[model samples]
Target chain A: MTPLPDAPAAPTAPRQPARRLRRFSRAERWVHRGTAWLMGICVFTAACLYLPPLSELVGRRRLVVTVHEWSGLMLPAPLIAGMFFRALRADLSRLNRFGRHDWHWLRTVLRKRSKEGVPAGKFNAGQKLYSAFIAGAVLVMIGTGLLMWFTHLAPVLWRTGATFVHDWLALLLAAGITGHVWMASKDPEARLGMRTGSVASWWARREHSLWKPDDKD
Target chain B: MEEPRVDDAPDDPGEENERHGAPVGRRVVLGMLGLGAAGVALGSHVQDRIDAVLAEVSAKDPTGVTGLLPGGGGFRYYSVTSSVPKRNAENYRLTVGGLVDRPMTYRLADLQAMPQQRLVHDVQCVTGWRVPKTAFSGVRLSALLAASGVRPEATAIRFDCFDGAYTESLTLQQARRSDVMVALTMQDKPVTHAHGGPVRLYAAPMYFYKSAKWLSGITLTKSVEPGYWEKLGYDVDAWVGKSNGRSDDPTS
Candidate 1:
């Protein structure tokens, strides 16, 4: 085989069309980042509660438990704030709204098929599933955590159940979030879209075909 | 420039089909299904009071149980999550040294050869729950200490757990309690990894914290070294109801 193209001649794609999509506005970005940090604090404090090694790591159980309580309390603050961003709110509300393509998307996901093989959009069936679970899980965690944290509104038995639900749901959430991370990490295109707000033109066509702009315009 | 809603179907099917339309009906069905899934989990949670009673009365943990309860599945059931694996009867050993006249080193077989004692009591955590009446079987730590002939100068016993993080201590008097045992077996079978297995310390009257998991080292000394938890600000003497200062019902 002949030697191929030389290094100096490599045609690099530039900021020709300024491809960055203004997908998330500043308000949406703030809400997203705030919740992300709050959730992160909760997770780390929770680790302190489970592992004996981390008891000293956080100083006291009360501190860890207190932080856990506050984290749970703060979890929905950002999402609630997101409601003010009409466009992003509309986008998320739309995600929760299932559609015809979602059935096809679900079938493709269930059958071990490639995302490339299916037509999709800004949020596929799977991303919708994540947002739905995360939203629901956070809500459950908040409500139950409050029950356990306070003594006046409920009985002792209620506290016990709340504690149980809090812990087991924590385990379940851990498992579910692992799958979430794997999906987001595996698709470089998806990762880039949220991280830097851009995607390869070809990637948009294959992964989120319905969202692709009309270039003929 | 903007994405179209997948559900933006025309009001009339007579207006045409997927040939040029969004599938609104299909979207509604799927949205209903997602809501249904969330609804199921939410409904179960909302009946929290009823569910709590049912669980407390009937729940049986799949893992081995410990502590005081109708079924022994309380939290004091010790299990290792990670360890120096592949130990066996021929290799495992327990040493009684430091302030003992006889610094005896007993192999796994040696421990089994010795006499045994069983304790049935609540396993209480410092946090204020007591799982009462869980059964534990092993030689009392005092029995082993007596057999080793602990020196009169020895005033405390320190336990080192295999977890690399858990350390616990007991006063000489507490260490000698008939209820304190370096436990060998739980629930009539070998302890599994989920509950600290092989060997562990079971101090019945105290908070479950004293029941160190993966118990490997015991040193008799003149004074107590505050335990790993104690050093980190947990009450040094972590009695079930007293330690955390909460009055929740004791867990055995």
Candidate 2:
């Protein structure tokens, strides 16, 4: 091919490197990971406590109970600690709000329609919903768990109600987390964002179109 | 490709206000925590109401799920029957009969007046809650058996309850163990009515269920008869750590 026309002269201007957008702060990532680890322990220990086969298999029942209780009691610690970080506070503010776009996004998601370029911020509508539910669930679980732990603090019916709610809600939470994991597995870019606190600029634009990374970050 | 630029953030007033505001949400959470503490502090009225509701629910809940959760303390209240009549010093009587030289009915005071033994042992429930180092004082079953003069033909001891439902048994050898007693006081106080009080059996080496509650009678038998829970598939020989397919540390 005539040596590709002697290789036309390359442009003199320096090409800018592809940018990496900051998706999560270090504080946010640590909070997420810490909460995840504690939640994992809680779930595992709860399974060992409730399931007969598991309970029998893991014979140190008293230790299992102690681990489960302490892990559950510590679930809120990371989130509460994250409040001191401005970035996390800003993100929490974002998560707590439900804008017109968010409602539309939710409606479209429920309709099973294309969600391409849905104008999600740092977090999507699904993520916002998940955060709300998880926050509420964590609080409720802690309250009920406290009642279960300090058995003498509450009466028979309250403890009964707490157990009933705790058991059923825990099942729901486990299911929700399974779905959350499945979604995370499907999106390697999102997983990278959570893991590294950053994502490719193009990916951010395509996914969280409304997200505006702070220059200071 | 067009260069994407950062947009001015905190666009929404709600988000802006939440970021700048004095963390009202966190305050709400802290307030809830405080309210929970207060609820526990002033829970007597709530306790009564809850107990009333529990009684109603217990009447209807056949599975006894209502009774499975731990009560005020660590103990789970399990009554096989729908309701147990409350027994106290005025009406409580423990009868020792069957295969004995002298069958005798004794009042609560008589047992209290007899030589008393105190035991501090872990109370283990087969379903798996333990109250460690619990103090129980009562007349030993062996002492009562010796007083009644158990006949030579008797091989086992059967326990009866005022609840009209629960029953328990122990081999003659098990009944004679120094650890086993007819528990009169628990935690240094007269066993409350809720705790199978006025009088109850306390088998220190066995599970709490084996310590028959609302104890009413002690009968000598020719063979070992399984107790109420034993009939329902619990181990007949429910020695902590050694029986019931479990290996937990022995309570004694």
Candidate 3:
């Protein structure tokens, strides 16, 4: 319309390469990996301790006890250390807060409905719930483990209850971890995100459309 | 970004009712709670029944493995010998000698007649099982040591068992704790042979190994001698939660 102004040729947008989205920061990934390894050792050593055949095969009860106790004691170390990182703290806060969307997502998943309409942000409702559960479990385990270790400090009833809870929760945790591994295996991209701290942008958009990076650069 | 809307109608009307059925959720939660309570009650009942059966089986078991199974009161019977030696109260004798000013031998009755002290303590094993609040009534070890007039140079106490092979020891200081006793009864009843009866050393704060079973001798020594399990790699000190490089909870 403005031949006179010959309208500055419509400004061309600069072309950019498609880049991977940052899913988990380096510190977050490290905390996850460290806790995962420690938890694996704890569960394995505990099995060795309780199962007669496993105990006999493993032998060296003293060594196994030491490994189990120390690994359990250190389970929370990485998470505690990661609190110093801003991104991790933010992510943790996000995980801790449950909203209507989360409830909706949980309902959809529980009913085996397509997750297509579920509104999830950086972490899905299932992931958030699992994170919260694991954090609570870690604390409970540490408390009970210490009581068991320092036998004289607590009353017999408390110790007994602690042992009961610890044992049952351990079994539950094992099952939960197995399910988590299966899910992760099914979604290789999720595993890739944890391992490499990034995921394909399209994968993130499809799986977590609500997760918009603040700075695409 | 705008927050996701929760009030939007679910894709299927039937699904909404199924998903948000509070009455169903409540019933499920209540059912789970009821099941849990029932489970606990059933567990205790089963435990009691199992204990009774185990107790009966232990009375006849020669291998002692059946006795090692955990019972209702956290008690387990562990015997190192093939069979519990037949020792009646009339036949049992406890001898205290070596480096002591007064060497004395007393029948089970004589030890039982001494001023008795009752204590409840946890019985800890090197293998990791624990029985709590086990009651033991007997003459205090300190009282016995005092009555025997321990010699100053006698730095340790050696224990010999009627089982013939098992032996244990304690330092002069350890043998004197208020909790240590030459126990004649356990759980308010006479100690059973399978449990190291007619009389056994009750080192309350130490592991069960340090509490020599089937006590037949207590000899004062110039130095500490490791016990049977101790000789075979168990901790000599065997303090609850402190020995064996394990900080187990004290069983006191």
Candidate 4:
């Protein structure tokens, strides 16, 4: 699938045409894909955790609970390990920054305007914000999760407070992640880039203007 | 959607059973509707009815009965059936059986006479609220299961509570967690009646419901049987930060 953005300007490149190189190494890609799938598993599991009548379908409540805990414990492992990669770290850092455009995008979202006209970047403001929020929230969840995991290390009060923060934030994060995934799915080019590791020049320029490769004059 | 707890969350959503009655909100509506069809619809505020119900519980045991008393550390109290009256150390008996080589019966004193463990941890309810830093003391569930000589084939352990309103089951592996205890004391002193005593299973890492208040029986089975809330709709595991309707922080 391709986007029909306005006609592309002729290339002025006097140097070799920019070709996409491996940004995320194979290990990094595996980590990313693994985590994405896991997030889905965790969220789905979390949803079932709330359903009062879930045990009959799931079987033993004890087993269901143990699965949930271990899955959660595993969720952050990939992310934390992936954070050590240079490219991933750089991407994450770039995605974390909030600038003038993000504020505008926020206003646009609040006003219920379409995203069609927005000038985007490596990650549009909303994407960046979503990434950061989820990153922070997941870390909080892991930290608090460990506290309630055992009686030592964390005091009971901390565990209680952490419980409130962990669950509420997870709800908020789940809702936000759902919306983010939905919106991102609209652009097949964006999906292609992540899946196949490349995007056509026009597609890149139209959507990720800030991240579009520099042209040779 | 991938079910996290495949054992508890069967692929089909329609077949689940919950232990804690139906969940709070929808169950009320459904219950009232079922009641109304019988021609006696109470046209009143639900809050009033809930209060009236609470009032009745308070009235039944004015001085507090066994497994109904709030402990020294400011604990919450709830009862399932109004008539189960209070029981104390002298009157309580805990039975262990089901798929086991030895079915052991213990007086409250006998259990207390076994080595005890005390833990200070957060007690999280699946609903939403939390009581923090709750101190509880009792014997480890692992020790008891071993004492009863659990069969090699045993897979799940079920808990039967004295209140009759509550029952919980744990995977044998889960029951062996070092933190899992059958609690006798909350906050330093002996757990008063309202707090699930002479003993309640204190599965610290799981949701409070999994703790199984007023615990009276333990049955080790080869497979799983849904606990009270599990029969209704709640996730069977009831672990803190994982299986509860709201996966809050972990209860370490």
- Report the lDDT tens digits of candidate 1 across residue range B56-111: 65465443222122122345222222233434566666777889888887776777
Better model by lDDT: candidate 3 vs candidate 4: 3
Tell me the tens digit of each residue's lDDT in model 4 across B71-152.
Answer: 1112334444443446787889999999899999999889978998889988777644456678888899999988989889
Cα lDDT tens digits for candidate 3, A142-176: 77788678766765545554555566567677888
TM-score of each: 0.54, 0.51, 0.53, 0.46
lDDT of 3 by residue, B1-252 (tens): 224455643333121222232222233334444443343334434454665787678778877666434452344344444444668878998889999889999998888789999998778776446666789999999988898899889999899998777899999998898899999999999987656788888999988888887899999999998887778677788888887655567987
Q: Is candidate 1 or candidate 4 better by lDDT?
A: 1
Shift in Å, residue B252, candidate 1: 6.3
The parts of candidate 2 lying over 4 Å away from their true place are: A1-17, B1-252
True contacts kept of 3: 0.01
Task: Quantify all predictions' global Cα lDDT against the true fold.
Answer: 0.64, 0.76, 0.72, 0.63
Cα distance off (Å), candidate 2, residue A98: 1.1
Error of 2 at A113 (Å): 5.0
* Distance from true location, Cα of A68 in model 3, Å: 1.5
Q: Which candidate number has the best TM-score?
A: 1
Top-DockQ structure, candidate number:
1
Worst 10 residues of 4 chain B by lDDT: B12-21
Ranking by DockQ: 1, 3, 2, 4
